[model samples]
Target: MKNLYFLALLIGFNLSAQELPNLNLLNLEGKSVSLKNDFMEKDKIYVFSFWATWCGPCINELEEMNELQEEWKKEINIEIIAVSIDDSRTQKRVKPLVKGKEWNYNVLLDTNQDFKRAMSIVNPPYTIVVKNGKIVHIQNGYVPGNEKDLYEKIKTL
Candidate 1:
């Protein structure tokens, strides 16, 4: 019975393994990048945080995640990526804001909304946690205390 259950679990995981699109985005220095190839690492828990400059919840979530950077790295092999979905209007402020806050994680540009659309994200403050090249968890909206839940999920990985 145990062997049958384990075999079923393996088959389920194999069938549900779908990767994000190999789309090109930009880094803070304005260089084109591939999200899967460049940012992702093998056997790591990486968080893709979709945010914008003007969003209050988004800012709060990112700042909270930034605070957890050092500890998360020390404990688990995790990386948090801040992907901005700001358009041309507010895109210029992204750099100054990030520099001002002194965020510790890598920032990526999705001004054209290409990456966001590809991922089917419809809102800000959404998070995707990937482990071993597979997306294990995703949160659509964030509340003030959502970081704790995210941490717990990563711990389970």
Candidate 2:
């Protein structure tokens, strides 16, 4: 039974890789946004990093990505959309936190966590490198130097 479940999960992930899941996550302004359907660009690669206000490691990873924002845009047409998986209890804190951090990102809210489960995201700091309507790479967690590696992977794809 465990093996069967694993197999099904694998197939689900494969399908997710081939096509972006249609999810109705809300932006910081409470407007519904779909990463693929609403924000598609001609050749832009999107990095969707799932995080929460309380996740320390998640904040670290996002900060690292923030530092490289200029270089990434200068080199490639890319956008990093930070998706907050904070529930309703803490959702109200998102705006102030973002402002305090000065993270110039299209901060989206996954207040219900629907997108996370639908995309099979297990935890915070999970990143999906997407391009041309498909997932190019996925990074589950991060270390201090992982941002450099992320940039290199984006360069190849």
Candidate 3:
């Protein structure tokens, strides 16, 4: 009985230890914000989606995420922040393109790629699920129906 109780406690600690790490990044307004400070306080889940204007897959994911934003928010307090990894030369196109698409979620520009380096993301449409400021899951590349799995993950959290 004593060994069983100790084993249960160890398992519980191990499960909690799998929580995500806290990393800071800039918002669309160019303001630095700690990921934990922004997403963890209310115990809500947030999605940090890295993207670029020229990437077709990234664009598709953003569009789908936009369409499902309202529904997802209703079910869970999820914030899908689309971070544009456009370089200085292409950065000028971001605003116009985003404005044209009429995407409603929070958008940020990663002109210097600092955020990308911090996250160690090498591709566009890289999505990370953050809960209470910790990264719980990461997915690289995007597919047409990937948002469904994302929503399921968020719902369970």
Candidate 4:
């Protein structure tokens, strides 16, 4: 019975993890944006990158993506949304960091972490690739050149 229960739970988690949590997050401009509704462009790929201001690897991932975004877009119908997981105290740093770096990403602020909790994301630099309102790929952590792998995956979708 215990083994069966565990299997059931595992299956349930797996299923939920594949779908984007229907939640609204605030963008850097302080506008509420629905992850599912607002971003649901038919046949277009959406890359949601979760990052925090303090995380070094997260910064690296976003910077790399920002640099490659234009070139990637020419080849794929893709959009990159950087979701900042910074809480109230650190939230102040988000805009300046993005502006200073001059990143072209659509930056969203997950101040209360509602979106993060709903998506079961545990760390920064966690990326999700979605299409037609469904999550098609996930990269849990970032290493140098991981963006290249992510770009390849997006091309396949």
Candidate 5:
């Protein structure tokens, strides 16, 4: 039932042309960055994967994407930004966990969930693909092979 509910949510949240929120979020190193200004490359696709330090599938999705990013970049102009939604309590674990995993993604700290609220994201492992400041695609959950589908979607943009 939980899976079904998540699926329903996922289907309902497939945003076609929503513009990204002009919100400033802190990166892991505590630098305030603007979502719109900092990531506005001419035609580059930015994959923002929202996750938390405690979510297993969230970690899995990022790990798989990390492994596949090199090959994907060879064929497309893309950047993956792993946005951590770990609030103040668990937020401290985020850095150590990221370091331990050795992920190469640009990590953004969404400590107050401003970005998540702006995006209306309900869960972790939620991914949004943005191009030219507009959200082109969104995936609400992670499965072992979902990275392939994400790659294919990015290719079409």
Candidate 6:
């Protein structure tokens, strides 16, 4: 029982220590925004989702997020901001692709990779849930039913 308690404490500490780095990225219109400022506040939780145009899983995850965004927002004051990791050369494709998909979430461009490196994210379809400027959850590789889990996390915040 004592070992079990120690193990649980270690897990809790590790979870709380995992943090998302501060990053500044540009929006589709070329305006700069700080991830720390834009996504977090004293009273709000932000969902920062990183994706790329070339990744099929990323596209599917964003589509799933869009479908559930409204309902999620109504229940919890959560906002999902989609960040595209496509480089500047391929940046032109982002707007049209997002538009074509009819995604209603806020979209930004991370063409310079500042955000990706800050979050230590090497793969597309990564998500970090931030609350009060601290990371609460970090997930890589999206699965079809993962949004339910995400929603539950957001609801708890």
Index of the highest-lDDT prediction: 5
Report the Cα lDDT for residue 51, model 1: 96
Cα error of candidate 3 at position 86, Å: 0.6
Candidates 1 and 5 compared by lDDT, better number: 5
lDDT of 1 by residue, 13-108 (tens): 853375766888888999988876875677888799999998999999999989878987888988899999999899999999999999987899
Which pairs clash (backbone N, Cα, C closer than 3 Å) in model 6?
A: none
The CA lDDT at 106 in model 2 is 91
Ten-residue region with minimum lDDT total, candidate 4: 11-20
Clashes of 4: 0
Instruction: Give the lDDT of residue 155 in candidate 2.
Output: 89
lDDT of 4 at 3: 100
- Judged by lDDT against the true structure, how good is candidate 2? 0.87
> What RMSD, rounded to one decimal, does every model reach?
4.8, 3.4, 5.6, 3.0, 5.0, 3.0
Clashing residue pairs, candidate 3?
A: 20-135
Clashing pairs in 1: none
CA lDDT, every model vs. true structure: 0.86, 0.87, 0.80, 0.90, 0.93, 0.84
Best by TM-score: 5
Clashing residue pairs in all predictions, respectively, total 0, 0, 1, 0, 0, 0
How well does candidate 1 match the true structure in TM-score terms? 0.87
Ranking by TM-score: 5, 4, 2, 1, 6, 3
Give the per-residue lDDT of model 2 (tens digit) for 43-139: 7889999999999999999888898999899998899999999999989888999999899999999888987887789888899888888887888
lDDT of 4 by residue, 66-111 (tens): 9999999899989999999999999999999999999998999989
Error of 5 at 63 (Å): 0.4
Give the lDDT of residue 8 in candidate 5.
81
Superposition-based RMSD of candidate 2 using all C-alpha atoms, in angstroms: 3.4
